[model samples]
Target: MSPRLVLVGPPGAGKSSVGRRLARHLGVELRDTDADIERTAGKSITDIFIDDGEPAFRELERAAVAAALAEHEGVLALGGGAVGHAETRAALRGHTVVFLDVGLADAVGRVGLNRDRPLLLDSPRAQLKRLLDERRPLYEEVASVTVVTTGRSIDEVVQEVILHV
Candidate 1:
């Protein structure tokens, strides 16, 4: 099975929130690869990063994303870095991937001081800016449509996503 919609973006881009509402609006389930990875690992993402390291965490994320893309028939929201994997990007070729683009300021505000994010634990603002800059092209490469979520409400973002899907 294939997903009806796939959401990709950096952290605080509202992929999870938008995915949930979009799934409900479309009368389908929402599968988030990050949650799936956490479940399969039997630990939190931060713990995985602490124990196994970023490369290891990324491997698990890649697998989780591939599995979800292959098996899920609902809306799928990918981990922010999923697009960094070449295989995952190739696999997203035919799916309706939406890039939830959010500016640095909005992203920093949305995810402020959240310790759950391992990548942002040190100097969140600068780190987030680097991540957004580095990952923007990858997100754009796989996405069929792009939705700017900066300064917009969740409802507005959801509605914009609905139009493309």
Candidate 2:
């Protein structure tokens, strides 16, 4: 079996949190590409980016997403920038991809633009805005359904996804 639902969106858009709840609701496990990449590399995403660069990390992400799409019969959540890669978007074509959209303010509040996030190392708000702008189109391009997550509770988001999927 393949993934029942796949999630894509910007950072702090609640993909991980919402994916967890959605997976629980659907009685399936949650397979997160970011976590899988970290596990496979034996390093955190931040370290991978700093040491190996974005291109290298994207390669790992692409591989992880492909594997999850093939092997995980559950809910899958991808890292924020995963959709930027052409190959990743192509791989999502036949899946039920959900885009969780969040505004800048809500994102900052949720993620705190923390140090652990490699991409947000400097001027987090500006960086996040740029990321959202660049990636929103990609998310829209691949999403089977788009869910706006600003100011909504996890249960609300889960309910909406359940109704759609």
Candidate 3:
């Protein structure tokens, strides 16, 4: 069986949170590629990035996403930069992909310049803006539905996703 819903978006877009709720609401398991990566590497994403670099982390990420997409029959949440890879986007072709869009303001609050988030370690606001600029189009391209998560609560976002998914 294939995933019933796949969530793709930038960090702080609430993919994991909404995914858990949506999965529970739908009575399905929630498979997060990031968590999968951490489990596989036996380290946090930041540690992987710092110890192994982004290229290495991305390779792991791509593999995890591919495996989850092929094997899971539930709600799947991809890492923020997963769609940056062409193969990941292509792999999403026949799946119900949802893009959770969040503005910089909300994103900064949700995803601060925390040590855990390697990408956002330097100037979170600016970095987030750049990330959004580079990745928004890609997210839109693969998304069957785009849910703006700015100012919306988790429940509200879940409702919107439920309506679309």
Better of 1 and 3 by TM-score: 1
Tens digit of per-residue lDDT, candidate 2, span 26-140 = 9999999999999999999999999999999999999999899999999999999999889989999989999999999999888885987899989999999999999999999
Model 1 per-residue lDDT at 150: 98
Tens digits of per-residue lDDT for model 3 on 1-165? 799999999989999899999999999999999999999999999999999999999999999999999899999999999999999999999999999999989998998767788998888889889999999999999999999999999999999999997
Q: What C-alpha lDDT do the candidate models reach, one value each? A: 0.95, 0.93, 0.95
Candidate 1 wrong stretches, greater than 4 Å = none
Off-target runs (Cα >4 Å) in candidate 3 are none
- List, residue by residue over 17-70, the lDDT tens digit for candidate 1: 999999999999999999999999999999999999999999999999989988
Clash totals, every prediction: 0, 0, 0
For lDDT, the strongest prediction is 1
Q: After superposition, how far is residue 149 of candidate 3 from its true place, in Å?
A: 0.7
Summed over model 3, clashes come to 0
Residue pair clashes in candidate 2: none
Winner by lDDT between candidate 2 and candidate 1: 1
**Mind sharing the TM-score for model 1?**
0.99
Number of the predicted model whose TM-score against the real structure is largest: 1
For model 1, what is the alpha-carbon lDDT of residue 136? 94
